[model samples]
Structures are given as C-alpha cells and as structure tokens.
Target: MKLLKGLWIGFWSGLILGLLLKWIQSVTGEQVYTLLLNVDFVPVIGSVQWSEITEFIFHMIIALVIGVVFVYVAKRRNYSFGQLVLISLLMSAPFPFLYFLLSWLAVEAEVPAATDWSAFLYWIFAHLTYALLLPILYKTFERKNAVSQ
Candidate 1:
C-alpha cells in the first residue's frame, strides 16, 4: 500500500512538474536545460537529450525515489498524512540545489559553466506544485482507504 501510494504520487507529480516546467520555459523564452557540452569544457559526463518521452521516464524515476523516501521518513516520524506531505515537500527543497550543483559538476567539473537561474525557478515552482497537490491527493486517497476499511 505504501509503495503504491509512493508510485502514484511520483507519477502524477512528475508529470505535472515536467509539464509546468516546459510551459514556463515556453512562456518565459528561457531554456530550462542546457547541453553541457555546448557550455565550455563540460565533457558530457552524462546527458539526457531533451525528449518528452525520455524526460517523462527520468521524472518518474526520480519522483518515485523521492516519494518512497518521503513516505518512509514520514512513517518513521509517525506523522499524519497531511503532515507527511508537508514534511516531504520541505525535504525535497534541497533536491533542486543538489541537482544543479551535480549537473554543473558533471558537465564541467566546475561551477558557473551552467548557472541557469531559470532552472532553479522552474524546479521551485514544480516542487511547490507537487507539495500543494500532495495533501489533496492524500486526502482523496485516504477517503478511499476509509471506505475500503
């Protein structure tokens, strides 16, 4: 049940985040991601070319891990569903920063090679959206659980 919950949250949240980010990029005329190779001496440590399908897969995987970890941590803390959602969102706050740093390092083993504030803003909005929706989803699902019980 917990695992299922995690996967559900992950899939939906990831899709929402991805779409929102893309939309924001389109509207702002800013690119959310940059090919590190194009930046400088940023050898492609790893690259996921911006394909919708590939992006979906990657988002799903990352969100799944995040959701699982969030639920596990929340359970350990004995938090209510609402509380868990909030905590999980807060916990995920650092993910964007970490991702940015790792991305920059992976590309060029240095900072400032790819310092896109838009990416950070995109991540913030996406994460916040996930956080906001999570509690609502939890409540909806919890009602279902109650009915089943």
Candidate 2:
C-alpha cells in the first residue's frame, strides 16, 4: 500500500515537474536548460531520436526510486512537511546539479552563456519546485489515505 502510494506520487510528481520545466523553457524562448535537449546523443546511439521520451522516462524512474525511499523512510521517522521538503530537495538536486556541472564543463556543449547565472538559478528553482510539489502531493494523498482509513 505504501509502496503503491509512493510510486503514484513519484511518477506524477516527476512527470509534472519535467513537463513544467519544458514548458517554462518554451515559453521564455530560452535556450534549452536540460543538457539532453541539446546533446547530440544520436550519432552515438545511431538513429534514435527518442531523446525526449527517454529523458522523461529516466527522470520518472529516478523520481520513483526517490519516492519509494522516502515512503519507507517516512514510515520510520515521521518527518514534518518542511523536513520532507528539505529532504526532497536534497535528494533531487544532486542529479541535476551534476548535469549542470557537466554542461558547464563540456566545451562542445551548446549551453547558453546566460546559463552561467540565470539558467543555473532556474535549474535550482526547478529542483526546489519539484521538492515543494512532492510533499504537497504526499499531504494531499495522505489526507485521502487517512479518510479512507
């Protein structure tokens, strides 16, 4: 039961977050913030233009793993909403941050010059946004879980 709830929350939260980030970039007319969007991974893989779909699924899987872990941990510790949010950010930020580092390092990467500051901030904001949403999702479903009990 708990595992199912975790998967539900994680999958949706990650999908929503990924979609939201993509939408923001589109709306802002900004250069791609996500490295995968700009990477020439095709020649390496040969004929696979499924980059967008693959990235989403990869991130969703990551979120699912985090969600499952969070639920199991919460079962023992019972963190408050704020603590959970912090934990979520802590768990979520590193993966993207590492990407940001790689993007910064990759000389051949078509990264935005503004990414040095602005896009990096948005990257942080995006992760923080994900963290904020996950707990809210948890609390919402938690209410449902409680009432059903």
Top TM-score: which candidate number? 2
lDDT of each: 0.60, 0.68
- Over 4 Å off in model 2, which ranges? 36-48, 93-96, 104-115
Cα lDDT tens digits for candidate 1, 1-149:
88888777667766776677667666765544332112333345134344556545655687777766655665465567778666867876775675465555554323322366755666567668877666556556667888999
Error of 1 at 133 (Å): 2.9
**Across residues 1-149, which tens digit of lDDT does each residue of candidate 2 receive?**
88998898888788777877787677764444465344344356324455678756766887898777777766667789888787777777675665556566544546555346666665667667777877888878888989999
Which model scores highest in lDDT?
Answer: 2
Q: List the residue pairs that clash in candidate 2.
A: none
